[model samples]
Target: MTWQTGLSGFLAGLLISIVTAPVGVSGAVFLLPVQLSVLHVPNPAVTPTNLLFNVVAGPGALARYRRNGQLTGPLARLLITGTVPGVVLGAIIRVFAIPGPQVFRLVAAAVLLPLGLWLCARALRPAAGDRPPLTRRTILGLGLATGTVGGVYGIGGGSILGPILAGRGTPMTHIAPAALASTFLTSIVGAATYAVLALTTDGDIAPHWILGLLCGIGGLIGGYLGARLQPRLPEKALRLLLGSLATALAALYLFQGLNPSGGN
Candidate 1:
């Protein structure tokens, strides 16, 4: 890659890491478009490459979360059990049914639109810090839905899981660590699944390892710093920011879906 492009990738990774890492995401949401548009590498490979980035970047954040005693193995297990199969289903759907960005974005936007509105509305209400814990059924459903979307979109379902739970007024103190652990494990499974597919199938999909690694390196540092900052950050302020960001991203993708001529 050119120096200019390399710089862009690193900076993008850093920025996304700071924005999302604090909330337990691995920066894949922002990186997907960069891969699709900037690198002009649009295919099934995009998702896994982002997953690869997660693999490289996740450990640093996970370490921080674990050190802080935020991560729980049981929670990770619960999330993964539901997410793994769901992601496999999503991968299959991407391969067979919704390969095009236009259709996929439309579907994604439709789902995110409601969630975004709910997040916004929730942001306006009084904070519910002592909300009831999520039921097993609820966790299962979240994992399935999140895994499927993560599989199709690339990255872990934490982007969906994090904000949705937060909107429900789950404490970020708990949500942050759990989401990070969940995303870390989810990315591992997703990456392995994609690697297997690459081996069995023709040369249709494979990660751009070099690029993914560079992004991951940047994300590692950013993620560490974000995690350190998260506890100090005000809960209400963070939720409002996330709610606004989610709605805006949904709207952008929805607009892009309408204007199919716009590449990536």
Candidate 2:
């Protein structure tokens, strides 16, 4: 790759992680547009590439969270248990099915738009009396669903999980670390699944390793900085930010799905 392309990947990862890490997101979802548009990475391959980004980018914030004593928890474990298998399943479907982008984009938008609206609404409202605790089943279900989406989209599932958890009254401190940890692990599994499939399948299943690495290096620095900054921000602001990001992504997908020229 040219120096300019490498620099663009690095800068994109760095800037995006700095903004998203505070909310427990890996920012890979946001990077999808960059990969498709700016980097011109083709479909299918872009999914694994984003998963590779999470594998490389996730450790920075996770290390910081571990140092701060927020990394180990039941939530993270449950999420992993559900997401790992789900991601594997999703990867198989992605390679074998090769679902049309328009259909996927519309479905993704349908799921995200409501969640984003709900999160934003919840953030704006006064805190109601504490909600009932999340059942293990519910968490697992969420993990499975998000993991499948993550595998297909290569987002590591944190973007979906973080906002929903935050909206449910989970403390940002707990949610951020657990979500990042889950994302890191799931990405590893998802990437591995893709790599294994690449050996047998006919299409572009392998990731763009050099670009992924460059982006990951930048994310490593930026994620740590974002985690450091998170403690200082108010929970309300963080929730709002996550909701806005989700909403923006939903809009982007909706546009892509509806526009004849987009998401081919």
Candidate 3:
């Protein structure tokens, strides 16, 4: 890779991670499109590559949360338990069932579009009184759905989960730690599932280690700093940022699906 491209990626990773990680996103929510449309990375491999970045870069925010006593081990365990099985099942489906670009586009557009809109609504709507607590069934169902989307879209699912929890009036403290832990765990399962699929499917889905690490280094530092700064930022501001990012990307994906000739 040219120094120019590498530098671009580093800066982008740093900026995006810093903004997104504090809200539970693993940053691949933004990075995946950049990789595909700008960096010209192919699919299958793209998913795994993004997951690798999550694995590499996730610890900084996690560490911060742990040190701050916000990690919530029991809550994290509940999330992981629900997400892992779905992630495995989804990865298998992605590799074996809907491997084609056109189909994948439709699936991605369909899933992300609604989630993005939800986030936007949450960000804009007036604050309500206390929301009822989420049930165990509800959490597991959300986990299953998020894992499926993550497996297909090459993300850790925190971007979607974070906004949803925030919308439900969950405390940001519990939201950040719980979502990050779940995403990190799901990403690990997603990457492993892709590796196994690569072995069986006659495709090369192995991560681009050098590029992943380059972006990851920036993400690592950014995550830590962002976590440190999270409590200081306005809640509305963070929600708007993630909400806008998700909707923008969702629109782009939808447009691309509608006019393949117009896409990168």
What do the candidate models score in CA lDDT, each in turn? 0.74, 0.82, 0.77
Model 3 lDDT at residue 252:
80
Shift of residue 50 alpha carbon in model 1, Å = 1.7
TM-score of decoy 1: 0.89
Evaluate candidate 3 by giving its C-alpha RMSD to the native, one decimal.
1.6
Best by the lDDT measure: 2
User: Model 1 over residues 75-169: C-alpha lDDT tens digits?
Assistant: 66777777778777776666667767787677657656665666567668875565677787898898899888887777677666776676655
TM-score of each: 0.89, 0.93, 0.94
Q: Model 1 lDDT vs. the true structure?
A: 0.74
**Model 3 lDDT tens row, 1-264:** 777767767776788888987777778878877777777767666778788878877898889988899985566776777777877877888788877665666677776677667767777888888788788788778877887877777776655666677767787888887888888888898888888777778775777777777777778888888898898888777877777777788778878878878675
Off by over 4 Å in 1: 111-115, 128-131, 202-204
| Global Cα lDDT for candidate 3 | 0.77
Query: Cα miss at 132, model 3 (Å)?
Result: 1.4
Question: Is candidate 2 or 3 superior in lDDT?
Answer: 2
